[model samples]
Target chain A: MSDSPDSAKKKILLIDDEPFITSLMAMNLEDSGRYEVREQNDSLKALETIMDFVPDLVVLDVMMPDLDGADIIYRLKNDARLKHIAVVFHTATVREAELHAHGGIISGFPFLAKPATTDQMIEFIEKHLPK
Target chain B: MNSVPPDSPPPAQSTLQQLEEGGALSQFASSIAHEVCNPLSQIVLATDLLAGPQPMTDEFRKKIITFLRQGADRIEKAMKSMLQTCAPIETSMVAEDANVLIETALASLTVDASVRVEKHFASDLSSILIDKKHMTEAVAAIFANALDAMQPSGGTLTITTYAKVFTSSEREGWQRQSWFRAGDHAVVIEIADTGHGIHKSQMPLIFEAFYTTKVAGKGAGLGLTVAKKVVDLHHGRLEIDNRPEGGVLAVLTLKSAAKPATFLSQPLP
Candidate 1:
């Protein structure tokens, strides 16, 4: 294994049911040169992909069938192995105020709204990722 | 008007005042709540499931919270309307800045990143006397309806304000019944969206209470009705025109204090 930090890239796991948004985020994140992106479109298979990828950061979409994003967070928080990884939420369910109120339990986790600009998405990922 | 005997007491005498009034208001509130509750309930159940002990991983919690927040916001709006209608007015009415109100309401919208929100405020326009809360709600309701008509596809929304003059004679039906005076100053705000225009037949019942074309559980048809009530409270006029380019144009006209009289405003044909 190469021990050089310069050549190594941080991987990111994206779990979203929507192909459009997920693909858009993946493309933008990949272009940012800071992340290696792995996507899981279905929430049910999200854990397997996360476990396999062991990403440095996780970006989750809220509205999914079987295994939604919030549940994924609860599980990640409890799992000691995955607990250290940073998480960012991307959703368009409500405005900022409502999100702020409901984001009470998920301290320190970053959030980005859907249909966001590439710059906005990149900024979120950069801010939440460990240096 | 003379059908009732001159010695007869008012209708209040025949009905139990508190029971009747409270019953009617509660029914209206319950109906509105019922309409909003469907979506809200889905969110709550979804949130509860997300919060359950079944183990939600780090990847999924954010999404569940978003759904719950949105659902709560919807219910809050409905509850706000109910409270506004049921509670007695305590604040004095005054001239309010239409531009400010519209901007405040638009800020709450979850406009897609692709969609651009544009506003054109008339600098010389006079302010209209109205309740700030109700006026804001009415304008917001119109904008919300417009957004629903244009969401996902993402398009530009233009809200414009202007000052105009209208004579009472030009206004008819409800306007005439309400005794709109000639030479009244009028302030108009138009919210134009880029979406599928309203159908012709739907126009007739657009303002009718409990009338909506939205899919079942999507809307209670109270948006326009509550909006109309707010407009009535402000002595204003609300009009919806289907634009040829494919969208709904909502025009809100409120009485202003100073404008030279022109042709009477024509009612919707």
Candidate 2:
């Protein structure tokens, strides 16, 4: 919100099939003035959006129809340009209980369950992103 | 006519049976949870935004409130459909015959003329308490699967209707180790086909929501789920097995209407 022309603002991409969740996260992150955010509902268009936005962090959903988060991450890992982009799987596909059951880890990344408060999502981003 | 006694509770079933039922329900609930949570997450964020220390004009506050209300209504609508699928149909249960129900389901199917239709209904088959429309749809779903399995090449669709008392253990044994209730006087409907049989491993997973072996667009994987739910609601069970020689045999059992009591009275001299 503040136009201070600071380079410190982190760029974040929120991708999920649910448009409402993306909108909510986008609004919260943008309002904080701490991140430049892009929201993509269609996972197939995720790469195109990433190319256009070139975000610092990506919040990917795992159960998307066009492409699952794991597949997207695999593609990202293969590509040099997008390989460095940090991703946190925020989804209902692998629930919180499942992660806990498996000793608190899934896909070797910080995971956040759906119906999460904005604070929890922001906290995860802050922890993962370089200060 | 006998009614369920007011003070008497229905007999308790095995934990295994309960577990199977729970699995079916939890699978369905997970789908609902995802849909419901999407809207719920929005409401949580919008409310947070409004309640936060950020300065907002009255118009903006109104907008946020509108989104909140919309999210709430969306959750309600999703939950209503979820409940509708699983809820008992109190008024629709009537004393209906299984033979008639099977015929009605068969008639509704869009089967090719080459597919042979065979019906063997017992003459004295007892009436069942069921919702006619749903029961028909459930049978229709099984038939749809049979038709798919034997596609292009035709097959015999042998449907047999008979009445029998099956103990819970017997139903369990019949499935070559499976699960269901203990005892019931049910009008059993067995629909057999001559098509390729189901893979044994996939049998248990078939009732699970979204567990589909069919190619995409050909199936939503809800047919068997709906059938199971319907049978459960009608106080019955559904079993699908591979026939020894070939193809699949799907058996549906529904509790029959209670037989009238015949009383003997002393005659006056």
Candidate 3:
């Protein structure tokens, strides 16, 4: 990742249960050298990782075991400090509209589907993140 | 069996009898379909209500919708099974790999993760001429039965296929006619499940229509029946035998449609 002496590089967290998919994403994103990519498979430790890593963008999966992505979005959106950090939901879930209509305002800033391409994820981050 | 009398109250009477029989079967199937569809409609309605733009703090609505979708799929399958049993199967022939078909069916099932699935297939085997949908349904039913036998509590499921030659001795009284010669080539597909083995007494009637060991609403006891019908439609023989290890083995023997060839060798032990 390209980081200036004065500013840190943008960090992206990719959370998903499927190992093959997440590893593929992490490899692709890390190889890009534009953004630092971190992966979390454990849903329970997701919030802790977010707090510790302080990622610029969070990529969340929906069909996780303990906690779902939508619920995590709700929690993140409710927190004052984390609210500013852009969350991009990535899941194989059946319904996307309901997640978008969280109390008339979508909690997750952007949503993406599973098996997403490299260009799509980067475009989402670029569009949503502050300059 | 008594044949229809020659007088037969004219051809119209026979036509009327056939029509009545067909109508009765259709009505019975439609009634079952209606019963299944009513609850499905309710689930859809419930989802619509839950998805209303109104505010709700709890997230149980999504869970309920998922449950309803699963329930609706199961019921839809049951109704289709019943309807299939009452009608003659219509098959469309295609070149299909048996191993691939079995794997696809297994993947689509909502089986328990604990159950072990093992596949032993002959890679050099020729493509079989069969209807993909009916074959898939038949394989899925057998797999579902195996899963039911081994889920929550785990067990191994083995699927194997190979070429074989059958004799009258092998079929015995099961064959309606002795059409088999000494060297009739056939393909055998075996599905073995390690559930609670079938009791000795229930063995004879397990595949009979309307005979089920499952409780009410859990199953209509038609899985094996429909499976057998599909096999028969494919000009195949469905055989069931108790496994030595404590389970059931369902073997389907389909006449080889590929070029005729002698048996290469018995599978390695």
Give the top-scoring candidate (lDDT). 2
What lDDT tens digits, residue by residue, belong to model 2 across residues A9-117? Answer: 8889998877767887888877777888889987889888888888888898865554657667777777898877888888765743344433443457777877788
The global Cα lDDT (0 to 1) of model 2 is: 0.71
**So what's the TM-score on candidate 2?**
0.55
Question: Could you arrange the candidates by DockQ from highest to lowest?
Answer: 2, 1, 3
lDDT of 3 by residue, A1-131 (tens): 34333245578888765444455566555555667778987777888888888898888775453455766777777888787877777654323333454563544256665434566666777776667
- Expressed as tens digits, the lDDT of each residue in B92-185 for candidate 1 is 3655667777877877666777677888888777656666666677788898888877766888888899887655545544545333567666
**Residue range B1-269, candidate 2, lDDT tens digits:** 12333232223343224336575445555656665776788899898788776788999889889879978887787666555555544335566767888878888988887688788888776677666787788889889988877777888889898877666555433332233345546678998988878777567667765445554224545678767766765557788999999999998876666531111233555
What TM-score would you report for chain A in candidate 2? 0.83
TM-score of 3: 0.46
Residues B1-269, model 3: lDDT tens digits: 11222321111122123325434444334335433543443354345445444354467556556656765765677666665565555566665667777887887798677888788887666555667788888878878877887755888899998876665434533434324456666677899988887777567656654445552245656777677656655557778888998888988776665533222454556
| Residue B155 displacement in candidate 3 (angstroms) | 0.8
Ranking by lDDT: 2, 1, 3
TM-score of each: 0.46, 0.55, 0.46
Model 3: how far residue B211 lies from native, Å:
2.5
Top candidate, metric TM-score: 2
Error of 3 at B87 (Å): 2.3
Alpha-carbon error at A19 in model 3, in Å?
42
